[model samples]
Target: MTDVTTPGTPVSAAQLEREADITRRVLESFDGCADPRLRQVLQSLVRHLHAFVREVRLTEREWDTGIEFLTRTGHITDERRQEFILLSDVLGASMQTVAVNNEAYGDATEATVFGPFFVENSPEIAQGGDLSFGAAGQPCWVEGTVTDTAGKPVPGARIEVWEADEDGFYDTQYGDERVAARAHLFTDAEGRYRFWGLTPTPYPIPHDGPVGGLLEATGRSPMRASHLHFMVSAPALRTLVTHIFVSGDELLDSDSVFGVRESLVKDFHEQPPGTPAPDGRDLGDRSWSRVRFDIVLAPGGS
Candidate 1:
């Protein structure tokens, strides 16, 4: 047999092995996309995805299983639950996105994953009010200040807060009528805020779905460290989405969603029985814990 080949032509065997060519071709397909940003993102995604497939030499069966897993994840997602976000959280993608986009300025609060449980229009709460209605947990007092990078108070800052009960469940996880352990409040003129709630406790990410299956198959724990979630916003400062972790939590080093950072860990002081609360509420004999999570908002945006 006679071979017909050109000097600049790629040979069939070599062409098949040049995996990067596949990525290039996929990227080229989006060249006509009207949105430059979307085109750029898709191109990068294709490159990374192809690189990943090549790195692992992914087999047909593995690819099919991944597709099936994603399909199932979507099937299980709805208004109440978000399996895709849960998957991203478990894979560390959500936290990485936050880190890339929310670089702190001066002493502005660091950002973390927004988790899947935040609700719109949470009931407005007054300072010193309790958020632990119909929820079971150790009593806790949270006080904080919203400030600028220069330490000036940002009065009237809106703070949206949520967290699991001591038994590791959010208000959303219950079907009951009453809401618990979550509320939205505003800072006082001095930029100080306070509320009463349950002490945070470590809990598992929902482990009954596809993401959970992936965790079990990969030998990873689904446990998140004890923490309180906060989203703080002011007129001219960037909105901050973050969490304050329990300082001594066992899972701080192994949060299932990789959301823990050293700076976000805070001490939850155990108040002795019959002590006067910071808000001057008199409790007869009930022990309580207190955490002060002051926040500094980045300047600009919303």
Candidate 2:
């Protein structure tokens, strides 16, 4: 047999196809990867990506467009905003991912997506401190306990909370110097805690990216239902990332992110006038919403 070689020549059709085959074959290299979980995740990702390509009959131009769209999404992000998270929310990826990891096992608090706006290291305020920071909105009092699956109180749990104002705007949206509608509190010995904050209002997810374009093309609205965000953590329990939603939020049925779990919604009842708050603050002449709920957590794994 005679050997034929074409040095520095453009790859032929058979050669190009062979290269793709080699790439796929190389992905199978992970079959022997050290970490089982990582191997499974990568293998599944590759399979789905390849399947999606075939299903969509994707083209080179379309792939380039996708890359450009992602680049633009990254370019638009700033300190207080994240377009990638926005993209995930619109595509239902964020909700689906949370649902997979945060199953409500035996009445444990249901987890939800941690939206892009949460600021870490928020100022710690005493129980019943006003998270609303005197902002104008329907007032609300939230009280709850953190407990283990056995119903034993989990004291010293930290509850980090944030929510939108009456107009559905976060304090960060207004560029405010003071932290409004956000606070951190610790549970008492009995695992009980309470705080004051504005009742949440339905708000729109940022709609100025590729995701927004997809929504517009599909004739979908971008509003998220009214809800309160909470990041609760304790010394020996799985940290919870979840939300308490207003029961009657108009957009609940059509939440943009698909994050409204029926079990997570509760009524925000108006407190009667002149009722004294547990913290001894006079709830005089003001309308307020009240939520009394408890959280359950799984035991630490072995």
Clashing pairs in 2: none
Tens digit per residue, CA lDDT, model 1, 1-302: 22213444334656445665777778899999999999999988898888777656678999999899999999999888899999999999999999999986998989999999999888898988888876898889999899999999999999998999988989877765567889999999999999998889999989999999999999999999999999999998999999999998889999999999899999999999888888788867889999989899999885
Candidate 2 is scored at a TM of: 0.86
Question: Which tens-of-lDDT digit does each residue in 153-232 have in candidate 2?
Answer: 98999899998888877877776566788889999999999988888888888786777887898999989999999988
Cα RMSD of all models vs. native, in order, equals 4.7, 6.6
Which candidate wins on lDDT? 1
lDDT of each: 0.89, 0.82
